[model samples]
Target: MGISRKKIYEEIADLIMQDIKDGVLNPGDQLPSITRMAEHYQVSSASIREALNTLSVMDVIEVKHGQGSYIKERMPLGFEHEFQIITRKDIENLLDLRKIIEVGCVELACSHADEEDLGRMQDALGKMRTAVMNNELGEQADYEFHMAIAQSTGNQMLVDLLGDVSEKMLETMKETRRIWLYEEKKSIQKIFDEHQAIYRAIAEKDSGNATGAMMRHLEEVATVLLKQHK
Candidate 1:
């Protein structure tokens, strides 16, 4: 008989719980960023995010926009209980939420993003191009650039929501990125093209055009990710 183990994220969550019990992470202290947690755990950011999400849902920790996750000042009741493992379906739903929220984010960004925000988006894109050219995963740069767009909306809630969505897509993004950059040996120029279109629309303050570009870009990416999983 085979022994069934906890999901990776569940295991990660339990480790956090242990840290809590050991007084390693004190109340009101911010946890490490998701990327750092992933590195520490030798796991994907998706797993770390899922673990954090479980804690957040349980009211044990707080996920604040812009700032990292934090230990709640007051521990929620039943903090000793086990967390339900996040499954593939949960990730899919998170992605779906991203699609819905980000399209709206781009629209709001068109009207709200200032010169500095747009410039930062451009800078992030440059970093992404550099990462891709060097044959690196570029996942960090990619996530940053996308998060910049969400931040541009000036809606903290939307920014926070998309931040969670970014992690859920991490694994799928890696697979599709490999297929696009290595297996097929295709230029990721299309990615730049789509991002450029979206950026230009936002810079021009063309809400309608920005929304359309974002929709098309995300829809195509979603299709590619789904195909890879299939």
Candidate 2:
């Protein structure tokens, strides 16, 4: 039997999700127009619109009346409940998935990133440093650093997905950090050092080192979370 309209919409959603998973559709990048998408998917424009609406409610994308549909910034970590029912297990899964995806993204970014992209990453890192030194909210800065790397991959979907994932993780980390209070200053310093390592690996165009650095950072984060739960 032929596919139904509902099935078509579902497929469209899956396509968008896959793009995010593969790092093709980046955050902040405008989605192709309904007409364009319809032509690409060989579906009715109405179906495409419906799929886009669903993504919008999920905070996966934002449709600004006139400007067009763009990916939304990542939601702050603890704010997942505001949009969806994200459980602790979900958070753990997200962390694992992020570890795998981010490692690849860093490796790709090291090879693909240009001077302008590197400059942007350095700028984000500088913000993180300032935030840590001033005892301000560094979560955003940290988020930016990762997002910048995702951007460097020249993949819009990957950038958007990572931004969304990181945003939620950052919120979770903020709450966890507050509860643990394990040498706040020292912990912050460790984070800075870890970020520096990732940055250096990317700067040197060493994909292997970048992946390794990312893994170490994620491992440290996971270790902390595990200890807190125990």
Candidate 3:
């Protein structure tokens, strides 16, 4: 049997949820209009509107009358009302998925990266170094460096996915850093070294090494998060 409209709505809801959880739809970001979303998902506008309304009721989004639907920024609470819900496991799974995708991206980037890509990466690295030395604005530089790598892949879909993953990781890292009472120096240096390793691998067009380096870096970060949570 063909999938029912209810099932289609659920599928759309799930995709939106994944995007939200990954931070692609940031707080206050307006979603596409119902008609646009409906067209994209090959569903009725009414179904899209219903899904948005459901999300709004769950506090995952807000729909303003005569305005549009916007993502909400509330932190997920455990065992709360249906409004806000997320678990530690969910965060871990997201991080794992990010690592998998990033490994592939690094491989592709190494194969396709150009001089302009290298230049942009160098700029990001320079900013990161300055931020580390000056003890200011490190987070932004760190994000830029990773984003540069994602851009090097020359794949819009991968770039977009990384953007979403990076945003979530940034928020989670901020919280993890606070909880661990960690200083930025050692972490920054470690990340700088890993970035250098990845850059060198890409420059040499060593896809295997590029993917390995990226995975190692992600594993290190994951280890830190797990330890902090423990």
User: Per-residue lDDT for 20-124 in model 1, tens only?
Assistant: 767787678899999888888888888889888767654568999998899987653223223323344554675677779888888888889988899889998
- Steric collisions counted per model: 0, 10, 0
| Tens-digit lDDT track of model 2 for 137-199 | 476777788888999999998887876676567765554443223224345656777899999
lDDT of 3: 0.69
Worst 10 residues of 1 by lDDT: 77-86
Backbone-clash count (model 2): 10
Query: 60-81, model 3: which lDDT tens digit per residue?
Result: 6788889988877664331123
Model 3 RMSD in angstroms: 16.5
- Per-candidate local distance difference test: 0.71, 0.73, 0.69
Please provide TM-scores, in order, for all candidate models, with all chains considered together. 0.58, 0.59, 0.57
Q: Is candidate 2 or candidate 3 better by TM-score?
A: 2
Off by over 4 Å in 2: 1-86, 176-181
Clash total of candidate 3: 0
